[model samples]
Target: MSHKDTIAAIATPPGNGGVGIVRISGGQLESVARGLLGRDLPQPRIAQYSSFIDAHNNTIDTGLALYFPAPHSFTGENILELQAHGGAVILGLLLERALQLGCRQARAGEFSERAFLNGKLDLVQAEAIADLISSSSARGARAAQRSLSGVFSARVNALVAEITSIRVFVEAAIDFPEEEIDFLADSDIQQRLQQVIDDIETLIVEAHQGRLLRDGIELAIVGRPNAGKSSLLNALAGDELAIVTDIPGTTRDVVRQQILIDGLPVFVADTAGLRESEDVIEAEGVRRALQIQEKADLVLLVLDASTETPENLPVIPDPKRTIIVWNKQDLVAGEMPLAITKGLDSVIISIHNTSGLDVLKQKIRQHAGLNEASEGVFSARARHLDALHRSEKLCRHGLAQLQDFSAPELLAEDLRQAQQVLAEITGQFSSDDLLGEIFSSFCIGK
Candidate 1:
């Protein structure tokens, strides 16, 4: 775990490829490279062709050797990369040779961990590396790239700078009581505090969108028997993911499918129809349907327009997060029922005709808080949102203390707390445990 110890790992994936790399990073990289390459360090940042040698001077594999001197490498330490034939056994032998040369195998994310410890990268950027690698969509990859390039960090640092200035001003007012200046009531102080609050609000909104893009949404399609729930799922996914039939309870279990809606992944689960049935299998399906509904981020209540009346519409849980979709629009002879509207977002769509599905998708996208414009979107995690929310709460509480209680001291302390919470986002103030939990999720030799 200590950065002082040299670490080496096969940087390539665990399969045979055209080329494989063994990455070494630490202070002792120079000696390790000499032992493996049997030559003086290659020119810095230059890929020199060389033959890797064993302890007995036996030629292992001839490829390119790259060297990055300390303070300029990915880990802010001396780094050596050996490019050899990508056979699994060859890469393993190369890694083993480095281990014999006094290098230990790197733990998961050790490279990025070293970079973070050495001030080469902030916590957000360090996390962005993994996000970028695992992004499923093009937009997601672009957003993660922005975060890795420090766009997200810049926003967080700007807020931290503002908070620092406020603390200094407030503390200064408290320190000099002889001036008899009511700093808490001063219009300038109020304006500055309000501006900071406003800025934090904006950041929170953007961070929310980033989180949705990173984590996506969980959507469950639930309704009574023969309500075209399976049809809607197929339409959204643009594939035959679920079996459709005229027989009730055709889908006896939950069928899951993932679809990208404008770069945001939506995990759609088509659950069995919700109805009371004496059959054991059907009844279990109904139970599971209710369970999925409780855990889903958004629920689509599909109702057959021809058979379902407004008065018979099932009571939905969490009406705000639920969308009522009246399906089979073509079957209904006259105007559709409008009485079921309970302020919930409702759409009338004929899954057979492929009509109104776009509106349904738009509603789902709105649920995720992602607009058509993807500008300024960055990769974020749940922890970032949590920190932002706590910071905002502290700022609001501090403002309340200053305005209502006229307690400048209390306001200053709240501001400090807010500052600390925001610092956690950028790793300025973080615990070893939090750092371990975060980086451990990353792949080794990151």
Candidate 2:
């Protein structure tokens, strides 16, 4: 529970490999290292060939021992890393030996949590460390690295500095009520506020792209029975993940697939065909399909172009988030119907022939705002976006108060709230519960 507790864990992954690492961190690391190495702690930051010993002075393994002193280590504490033959049993014995030497087993993410608490890294950077380790693509890893290097934190800190300055000015003006200088009505202050708002808007857009790269997007494919929903899923996923048949309701459950588009993951769920059914199981599948459609970031309404015109369809998807996919276009007699395409984004595709699938994929990427150049994007999480949105809303509300009501006090309060909300992104303002929830997702030994 406390940073003073010397913690140790097997840093390497499970199973046998070429080498394994047992990491230790705490104020007591110096003596612990001496106990394990059977001699004085090695020169700081240098790897020394030594024998890892057990409690009875028996050599457990012969490998390299690396020591890092306090104030310059990853966790801002004395640290030791033991590199030995990478076998599950060997690593376990080494970790057990450290526990015998006054070190407790580290919980998941305890090391990075310590780094955050010790000021060596902020919450964003600490989270980025985990993100980097779990990244699925090179681009995602680069984005996480950008966040870890303080790119995102620097932008947030800049916003906080500006807001703090404005708050100080407004509070100062409120204190001097007798002054004729109308600071609240000053055009310069309003312009500065507006500029900050614009910057936040821009940051929000970039963070959204970063989030897509990190968490990806959920796409639900839904439509009436026998509309080639499973065919489209197979085409997109490049595998026969779902059964494609002429029979209606062939897919009685949702079939999920992970499709990568230029390093961005797309979790595509091919849900059961939506239609009225007498069978209880088929009806349940239809109900679950609707639920997935509602929750998905984008819904693909696959329509059978060969059967009927687009206007005659009984159900219409939410135009804002749904893409009308007119499938089986190869069977259509003439050019596609132009009606019912005015409001929503629709595409003509032949899943059987694999036509227009590229366009569909591009539309998906565009919907996620990831079709653009992603250079310099810093990875972001849902919480970061939520905080940014809340902060932006508060700033907008404060601007309204200043402009419409000329209420400096209300505007000042709004600014304070906005500042605090922004601070949460970097852990400047965070509760213990939030910290625990965030770090607990990280793998142990991080």
Candidate 3:
């Protein structure tokens, strides 16, 4: 797992600041450090002020040089960190000197990738490092930190162990065809299998919640012209993000705003009113609105409470994913029509007065699957969810095969496949292409 050549990069962001760091990792750290510092390297894990010397023995800069010997560094290799002035030119000069000293520029996410290869971190933890750096909210950063601390990996590993134990039992049964039926029928075996399946299902749900924290949710606002869609967007965002006009079709395109609800990111899109229009631009807006609704996690169907419910309200593809919003409630003198309000999932509010906005926000949070208890949830990605789902499906299929009592070998194979699928979540069974694709998306110097 050791790298023969050294890799170096400016770990700090590409900007001038009080300080910047140039990080190096590889087997040749001592040699490279000697070449750059023109002196004995600092003691292991100790920072020492030193003059950075270049090829011609000219002093390039003066900074703190800290060295960490192999097996105890971030990448499990000899690591050297140069803390220097934050000037971009200074960092570039230091990087160039390192490259001249036999180290090359580190690729994007290479440091974390090396950590994964060296067993310093698992795939999930490696990804969590990137997630933690990119998190947009405090809650999200905390969740990613939990994942980096192995909260998510521990759960996955526990599930993997359960699968391994069950697979061992199933495979043992398969070896003795005559006793296989009885073995599968054992109450303990059936219970263990069901328990594992249930645990996988639970993990899937929690991972989904974690994914929402990491990736956020998309809420599409859709309604007839002048139904306060723009007003609702403005209210949720706490700013006038969209133009509100009494004129129909004022908004002829999609306007998006990112707002946080209870520390969870929500991307709200205010689209043109869903209505039949002769104007080409207006028609296109309606088309885009409908398209966004089809893909949105939740759709806010805004209805003007001051006016009678429009008979031609846009069809909600999934009622469960749609929130009926009755806006302009302040203009209504009496109670809302029972026919429109009763037996329907709806929230009434006034955008001008901000009435019932809290309830709407709460609803959005509820729909996004976030709560006060989410503090402990670990961040997850769509790929992790996909792997979990595949594992769950395979586990269920294996259980069904056991129930049929005709194909013990098939059940054993199913369990084996399920175990492998779950293993991919932690990089124990991942393809190189998947690893490449995942790391390539990370920012350079991560």
Worst 10 residues of 2 by lDDT: 308-317
Candidate 2 vs 3: which has more lDDT: 2
Clash pairs for candidate 2: none
- Residues 1-446, candidate 3: write the lDDT tens digits: 23566899999999899999999999787778788898877999888999988889888889999998889999998899999999899999999999988888988888898889899999999999998999988888999999999999999999999889987877877776676446754878778889988998899888988899889999999988999999899999989889999998989889999999887889999999988889999999999999999999999999888885546556755888889898888888998753664566789898889899999999988887786587679999999999999988998888888888656788889888998998999999999899888888877777
What TM-score would candidate 2 get against the native? Answer: 0.96
Candidate 2 residue-wise lDDT at 139? 89
Which residue runs does candidate 3 get wrong by more than 4 Å?
177-181, 310-312
Query: How many residue pairs clash in model 1?
Result: 0
Model 1: residues >4 Å from true position, as ranges?
none
Residue 441, candidate 2: C-alpha displacement in angstroms: 1.3
Q: On a 0 to 1 TM-score scale, where does candidate 3 land against the true structure?
A: 0.96
**Candidate 1 lDDT, tens digit per residue, 239-270?**
98899999998998899998999899999999
Candidate 3 lDDT at 42 equals: 92
